[model samples]
Target: MNQCLAKKVSLQILLVDSYDIALNATAQLVKTQYPDGNIISTRTANDAINKIVNWQPDLIIMDIYLPEKLGEIAQTKTGLDFLQQVMQKYPKLNIFVQSPYVKRLVQIKPAIVKHQGGFVIADKNVTSQEMLSIIDGALKGFTRIKGITDIYIYPDIYEKLNLKPEILKLLSLAFNEGLQDKAIAAHICVSERTVRKHWETLQAALGIDCHELRNQGINIRVFTKIRARAAGLID
Candidate 1:
């Protein structure tokens, strides 16, 4: 084993969620990976803010929706509100927000990006492997979360291209997995000929010529991914 892997580094992590079962289970899972790390769990945004201020954790894992009712007369504070506050107060803090709602992610992504902090939004149902990867990436200063491409694609560029929803989905699949036309057709329940048509439309719209790239030993699938990232379609 590498000496660094054998040695444990001390870290402090905070997990904020309204569900007690999920909160404790996530804490235990993280504890196993970071044996020397401290994990704190909180249900409400207020408690999370307090812990964040006092503990100064190295990473924070939060839910997009958190209970914020203080009383009948008190104004309710949302998880997004808390996130904005945290980002403004501690610009360099690492934060991971989980939610299954795509619309919510779309609404908050720009703000997170503008904050320029180590922040990532992940699906709530992420697998254990994906969860670990996201956490590791955040600690290493990566802002993009795995399997969430909609947030990466610039809406302005997408609109400028005037691509249909199906075309956008196809491009995302290609960029993410580099799937061949047949494989993509199978996944989308379409014929291979239809897939080729869509690919040709995308090439014409994006000004990419597959035949030209092939002559230079560059596969179109790989080139599409590179171009998407260059165009801010994928991070």
Candidate 2:
């Protein structure tokens, strides 16, 4: 290697997160490792996209939920779509998803595997040392998605069951809001029949046994919620 080329590159980190506290905390934590690192922070997907296209940072630490624009409510789909676009365009970009919703990345596991760059995930609540360790691994091209790799549900299973991201939204509505099928349909602007079909699909994907539930005199919906919670599909 040329002597100049062998010199270490200064780390460049881009953080895409709408929340100020998390963004600032993560930036400070990263600075602990690379005191002279360059960090760019963006609060919206559009802003982050522009930065990524122009700057090509060495690594990106982003939340899976972000606003599409300034002053907009942060949304998971918006961030996920942005991430997909980034991955498609920059297959070798190192990425770390820092959020409580890391499980949602399961919907894009196939693409992650196809990516040639470092990819890692950690819940927002992890210790600072753990976060730094994960970041180090990512910069070295390692891949790890916490709470996602240990699950029995694989990407192929998600494909086989057609478990789209919308299913995650449906689960949140059903369990977090305690919404019935009719109410969920109204909220999501879908037909009641479609909501019922989603429930059936979710139940099937969870390997729920309706026969056993009936025999045990348990309400199928309640049992499904319990299973989904245990599976980390819902809070």
Tell me the whole-model lDDT of each prediction, alpha carbons only.
Answer: 0.71, 0.83
Show the colliding residue pairs in model 2: none
The top-ranked prediction according to lDDT is: 2
What clash pairs does model 1 have?
Answer: none
Q: Which 10-residue window of candidate 1 scores lowest in summed lDDT?
A: 69-78
Q: Mind giving the per-residue lDDT tens digits that candidate 2 earns over 49-118? A: 9999998899999998899999888877687789999999999999998887877676666788788999
Steric collisions counted per model: 0, 0
Best by TM-score: 2
Count: clashes, candidate 1 = 0
Rate residue 65 of model 2 by lDDT: 87
lDDT, candidate 1, 1-235, per-residue tens: 5767644456889998877887988898888788888898988888889999998988998885677644322211366667778888988899887765433444344466766557776777888878888888888778874434554344544444444446655775676577777888888889989888887765655568888988998888767776665544443
lDDT of 2 at 54: 95
- Residue 50, candidate 1: how far off, in angstroms? 0.7
